[model samples]
Target: MTDDDLIARLEQQERDLLFSRFDFADAWRLGSLLVEMATERGLPVAIDIRRGPQQLFHAALAGSTPDNDAWIERKARVVERFGNSSYLVGRRLAAGGRELDASLGVDPARFAAHGGAFPVRVEAAGVVGVVTVSGLPQAEDHALVVEAIERFR
Candidate 1:
C-alpha cells in the first residue's frame, strides 16, 4: 500500500477503536480510554474523571508533568454540577444570571485551564459526572471528550 493508504488505515483503526463504547467500570475506565487514544496518537495527555463530589480516576502519562489536577477536576465539576460543560456556563452567565460555580470542593480558578472537559450524565442511573483530558492543546482536549461522548451515545 502507498503511504497515504497506510496512514488512512491507521487513522481508521484509531477512529474505530475510539468510537467503540466498551463497558466503563467507572469514570476511571473512561479516562483510561482517553489516555490510550492519546498515547496511540503520540499526544501527551492527563486525564481525570469525577462522579458527583468524588474523583473517580486520574492519570498523567509518562512525559506529562503533573501540571494541575485541580483544574481538571474543576472542568468535571462544572459539567456535573451544571449538567453541562463550562461551555454552557458562559451562556448562563451571559444571560445576566449568576451560576453557583459548581466546582464543588475544587478551586474556582481550576476552571481557568484551557483544556477540554465535560460532564457524564447517565439518564438511566440518574448519575452525573465529569470527564477531562489535558496535556494536549485545549481544543484537542475538548475533542477527546466530545468524541468519547459521541461514541458512548
Candidate 2:
C-alpha cells in the first residue's frame, strides 16, 4: 500500500481508540481522585472534571478563588469548541500572535480561553476526558492536571 494508505489506516485506528468507550462518570471519578491526591500532596487546586456535556465532579480546594470557576468554564468551552485541550498550544504556535477565546468561539482568539486544560484518558474506565484547573497561575494550572495524570497512572 502507499504511504497515504498507511497514514489513513493509522488515523482511523487512532479515531477508533479515541472514541471507543468513554463517558462522564469515568471522567468525574478520575477528576475527583486527582483532587484528592493533589490535596494530599499539599497542592492547592481547583478542578473541573467533565465528559462531553456533563460535569461529573468539581472541587475548589481551600484558597482557590471564585474566579477559578470562570476560568474553568472558559477553558471547558474552548475545548468543547475545538475538540482538544492542546488548541491553546496550537494557537500559541500560530505565527500571527492570535489566540483562542471562548467568547469569540473557536476563532483565532481560542488560546486566550483555553490556556488551562488537560486531556485524560482512562483505559480501565474506557473514557477520554479533560481536567481543568484555574485560580493558580496558568503554568501551575496545567501542572496540576499533569500531576493528576501522573497520579492516575
Candidate 3:
C-alpha cells in the first residue's frame, strides 16, 4: 500500500481498536489471541501488552529471537511516547521527510517509529496501554496486532 494509504489505515485502526474497559483479563485474552494467530500463520513473533510502564503480558514464540524482543520494546516506546500507533508515527515522520531518531532526538535504542506497536485505547480514557509484535515486515506486524484486536473486541 502507499504511504498515504497506510497512514489512513493506521488512523482508522487507532480509532476502531478502542476497548470499553481493559483489565488484566482483557490483556491476557488479547495477548493469547495474538499468539494464536501468529502461530497458526507460522509467523515468528514476540508479543507484548503493557499499561504505562507495567507489562501485563509478554511472549516470545518459537523462532523469535532476542532481536525481535528488542524491536518490541523499541516499538512499544514509540506508542507510549506518541500515544499513537508506531506505524502512524513512522508514516507521519516519512511524510514530513523526518526520521524519528534524527529529527525528534529520540534515542533509536529506546524508540522506533515503525509498524507493530499500537496504542491500547479505552473509551473516554484515551490510551491506556500498548500492544506490540515483532518478527514480520513492519506492516505485517502492525496488521497482525490490528487483526487480533478486532477479533478480540
Candidate 2 lDDT, 46-107, residue by residue in tens: 78877766677888888777877877876766555555454344334343454444334454
Per-model TM values vs. the true structure: 0.63, 0.65, 0.95
- lDDT (tens digit, per residue) of candidate 3 on 1-153: 887887887898788888999999999999999989999999989999998889999999999999998998899989988899999999999988888884586888789988999999999999999999999999899999999999998
Q: Number of clashes in every candidate structure? A: 1, 9, 0
Give the higher-lDDT candidate: 2 or 3.
3
Best by TM-score: 3
lDDT of 1 at 66: 61
Candidate 1 has a TM-score of 0.63
Candidate 2 overall lDDT versus native: 0.59
